[model samples]
Target: MTGWNADSIPDQHGRIAVVTGANSGLGLVTAAELARHGAHVVLAVRNTAAGAEAARRIGGDVEVRELDLARLDSVHAFATGLVSDHPVVDLLVNNAGVVLLGPRRTSADGFELQFATNMLGHFALTGLLLGALAAAPEARVVSLSSITHKSAHLDFDDLMSERGYRAPSAYGRSKLATTVFGVELDRRLRAARSPVISVLAHPGLTRTNLTPRAWEHRGRLGRVVARLGLLATQPVEQGTLPQLRAATAPGVRGGQFFGPAGLFETRGRVTEARLSREAADPAVGERLWAAAEELTGVSYL
Candidate 1:
């Protein structure tokens, strides 16, 4: 098959898309491009001011809603509002996530911050939005994974890194959980014969505010490196290709993963990404799903 790029995006007129973390970085670019292609995009972000700025910058049929993924109540409210306003959502992009923090912090619900925000929150959001997604003629749920997942493992006992926590380790585990959840969700959706499909993608080492912000809490040197990384790495527009392809590309299938085609999947054309043995394991996914449900009190097949 031919390689996929932003130009490969099919006509998305009449589609309704909800992109988490659309205020900046990869999410912002994804939302802007989708709106450019005629999809009515909703920027579900934590900061309304930033989201409004993003909407203005994107300058299309775009709307902004407040959503802090670290809080389950906020997730429920966002989904409920969407379901009432837009009955049928054609695309739901689970792209909001956080990376490396200085110390272990707990969310409003008391779960580990990274795990709660990156994995559990999206899982709950997907389930809450499942009804609207399935109501569409054919809806797709695209979860953003990471290349970091390749080096991670799910320590069930330390799922939240409660026993001990390292910034990179915690972040890796959270991303691995996200990728595995996407695969598992696809399996369940297929088994249930639901019209909704789950797809996963990673932005190959794109320079985004996330890394620098991760270090911002530390000091000036960390922030400077992040700024330099953006200039040195792939552009945010290119970084969004994988998720956009997964969400809108023609002939795309559930459970398939996409990422950059360059060295180590860091930056290049969009193509099927490699999954680690740990990420591809269904048993592990199932167990993680159960744990996620228990943690968030949100359940779905």
Candidate 2:
């Protein structure tokens, strides 16, 4: 995988790919690239209008589906609708995520917004779509993770951040939960002898709408910081290479992680990434998996 880029993506003809939050930014680039390579891409987003606009921009064998990951009901509906339409789904890119919103918030199901959108919803969606994925010859479920997961720690006692709330900590913890889920899913798939594989990827410090939106409430200084920070990061096009590689690259294995090759994984070409010891712990995986199943009311494998 030396110096890998989107151009390295293999031909995806006859494959069906689902990319969440594909209206703009990295998700848009991913969906477009997949479609460009002859895959029928599904732009799974919350807003149908924006998704339709994105589909027009992509101009390929693509369709739009409303999927709001912040709500369990929406997640279930989106998965069911997609499965009903397409029984075999080849690739699922869990790419949608929210950043620190500067305050605590809850989803319709009363779970933390970041946790619900970033981890729990994706977890439930994957389970619901398992039948469709497994029916494919060799399906891949790519979970979007983050460098924040390397430093963040999980507090099982307050996984929902009920006692107190801090934006950065909450966002980091959500990413950590996502990382744990990806690895754990891979293990379960292997144990079950399922043909589907779970892979993880992170776009290191990419310029995206979520970053500026996350910092929008912090006044003038926040705007300045967001601008300066985005200037220092890679473009969304470059940022998407890791996940695209994870999704379509040849020889990628289950449980493998892909990220930038730059210092601290901030920017560069795609390469193998390291997982935190905490994220690699089997005990933590089991605990988080159980919590996710209970919270989302979804179970599989």
Candidate 3:
């Protein structure tokens, strides 16, 4: 738990990894590090051109696959093709996300954009890829959550923020949902005696493209916060270490969450971070699981 960094990752020769939104930010870093450690990483991204560019930058055994997490059809197609092409998957990093979306927006599937992209899509993808993950020597499903989730609560009746919306609130709820899904997944996998483990991680206050992109709709306010954000963020290289540790560290267990070790968990090396009381509640997990299954129409242990 102390002094951990990407260099601590074990040799991953021959392992197969799939990372969502791997073209930039934490996702790109996660993919690059895994590949650097000898894993054949698949950069699952929305833009094929950008993904290709990212692959070239990564300079390793990497492939680009298009996947738009906001659309269920795309998620289904991506997972189907991936599972068929790669029968055994060692790692699935659910790292793609959008934040501080200024106005209400919906996905092709009609769900709130933030909820759909950050949580529901990953839920369905993980369930669809369960078989490939289970077949591995040891597999991990790493769900990227956030510090914002600690301040949010899920209201099942308003899961999609259909009645009303606020940028930060909606984003927080979406992250909370992702956190719940990760923990519940561990319990379900354990009960089923599955070999695949579920892990959680968050890059605290990292300088990423998500924040500036998210605030784009707000115009002037966007520019202001984006600048303030730049002042507070840790470097992308350091921001990525938490998830990297979660993915490749030895002795990491199901449901374990990795985050920064600094004050307020905003910046530092990788370490164990506490889950919010709400996120750890079994009842919340059960309800969120049912709602997710109902919403996404994907079911698995």
Candidate 4:
């Protein structure tokens, strides 16, 4: 198939999209593009001030709302409020996520901060809003994963990194869980004949605040890597293409994954990409799904 660009996105008039962390970076770009395409976009962020500023900058019918993914209560509140106000959600982008931080921190719900924000919170928010999503004729849920997920292993016993806190490893495991969740969700949706489509996408080494944040918490080596990433990384607007294609492409399927199409799958046009062997393991996916349900107390099936 040919590569996807912003122009290829269909007109989105009357559609409603909710993008987490829509204040900056790829999330901001995604929200802006969706709004530019005529969709009513909701910026679900942890900071109202930042979100409002971003909404203003986008210069569209974008609504800013507070949503702290580290807290389950906040996630629930955001979802409930959105569902109450909007009758249907055409797109839900689980874009807000943290990276390799210093220490292993727990969320408000006592879960690992990375896993909670990157995976469980999204899982719960999607589940809470599933009804609204299903109300739409064609709804799409796009979860952000990463190339680093290929090196991740789901350590059930050390999920919280209590054994030891390795920032990159923790982040990779969380993203891997997210990718697996997306694939498993697609399978369940197909079996149940659900109208909602679950898809996965990754931004290949994009220059964003996330990199700086990770480096800031790491040290000198991280700073060096961050600098290198800035030099070699793609623009945030370009980074958002994979998610946009997954959410908007007419030919996109439930289990499909999208990423950059350049060398080493690092930076280029948007195209369908292959999941790592570990990511596509059905048995591991099932176990992760069950664990996620138990951890988040949210279940779509």
Candidate 5:
């Protein structure tokens, strides 16, 4: 729907939702909308203060919990605490991510920061929380991807970007991996006759702090671009539509990719978008799945 808004969200009373990086940007908007619809939302964030403020701003039954997607230990701890507190999770939104700047930087576990936080950490957290998710009547996992994924290539040999580093390419690769994982997870869930739905979505060029913070240290030119881009970009609330649709729409199916229907899939109304050749590659997906499991030491199947 071209004019889709958060008001269209279905009633989510008694539902439980976990949104990563819900403190700001698209994640914040997503969490707020869910809470508005009567769902008990858990804001999984790295910054406790900001997350608490976001929860307060949402003005609902929102709970702020500590979660650092850049660290495996933090992911594990968050999962454990969530499981203990809430036995079933109706929705899990893998929305936390990072777009690194300049040279290569490694995560706590020595993996590429973008890949580690955007893909591996979510993988581990989802795997660890699968039980809670499956316990719900109709659980769903919405993986946040991006339009940039179409131009991405997964360099298996140099997955950590140790060979070379380009910020945009690295970010794109991580998002592509996330999309592939969503598709593969759907396949496995169907094959195993599971009760969970794995869906993917992208916020087409929404104005957010991600870009500015990512390119913050890149000098005056970078700052100018960030400022101008924000002015030209759609609001974060509108940008979250595709994701909210994928997570809660009645017609949304497993393995479907959603994005803005506007110009070049960059800005406009939410719709079912086409997948790239790389995203639909089963062999590549399986390979990535195996590699991810090996890297994170967490397996869903």
Candidate 6:
């Protein structure tokens, strides 16, 4: 799809959307745009203060809700609250994630930081919200992956980075798991004959606070490197194209992946991007899905 832009997003009237990490970056832009198109957008973020600011900026039917993905308790509370208020969710964009950070950190649940926050949290969120998603006539779940996923491989024995951890490697592996889960969820939904759909999208290289924040704890050199890389990346607005397309584009199929079309998919019009053979491996996806169930204690069809 050449020349694809936000203008292509159809009217989202009467639809309800839940966007995680919508306080900033790609998630924020996506939520704002969806709200502009008349969708009742909920900004599910960890920091209620930041989320409120984000909602104020968007200025629509957007509401801020506390959702700390790293903590299973917070995840459950958020999901339960959302279900009670809105029985049906037309769109669930699992877009919140952490970037490559220095050293190994543990989530509130004691799992590796990247894998827990980026992959596991989203996994549980989707599963817990399955009922709400299925209640909608035609629901769509869009999971955000990354180009780095191409270089990642899942190591079940060390899913939590117990053996060793490299910042970039951990980030890639987490993203790979997210991509696999997205695809696997679609297959399960199809097998169950559900109207819900799952699709994946990548932001490519975009100028967001993720890299800067992740590298902040690494000292001066890390910040310098991150800033240099950001200079060559596209704006958050352009970076959000693929996911928005995956969320609303017509004729979009479950399991399809979308990304940029130019310069190794770093920046350009939205188009179908490539997925690594490893990411397409059904065994890996299935095993990861099972492991996620074990870790998050959340499961779905």
Q: For candidate 5, lDDT tens digit of each residue in 164-266?
A: 6887889999999999999999998889888999999999899888887766577898888888777778988889999999888887788998899888988
Q: What is the lDDT of residue 152 in candidate 4?
A: 88
Off by over 4 Å in 1: 1-3, 216-232
- Which ten-residue region of model 4 has the weakest summed lDDT? 210-219
Lowest summed-lDDT stretch of 10 residues in model 5?
A: 209-218
TM-score of each: 0.96, 0.98, 0.97, 0.97, 0.97, 0.97
lDDT of 5: 0.91
Off by over 4 Å in 2: none
Q: What is the C-alpha RMSD of each candidate to the true structure, in Å?
A: 1.6, 0.9, 1.2, 1.3, 1.1, 1.2
Screening candidate 6 with a backbone cut-off below 3 angstroms (N, C-alpha, C), the clashing residue pairs are none
CA shift of 291, model 4, Å: 0.9
For candidate 1, report its TM-score: 0.96
- Reference-based lDDT, each prediction: 0.92, 0.94, 0.92, 0.89, 0.91, 0.92
Candidate 2's C-alpha lDDT?
0.94
Q: Indicate the residue-level lDDT of 145 in model 1.
A: 96
Count steric clashes of candidate 6: 0
Winning model by TM-score: 2
lDDT of 6 by residue, 1-301 (tens): 6878898899999999999999999999999999988899999999999999999999989889999999999999999999999999999999999876567889989999889988999999999999999999989999999999998989899998877788789999999999999989999999999999999999889989888777666789978987888888999999999999999999999999999899998888899999889888889889998999999999777
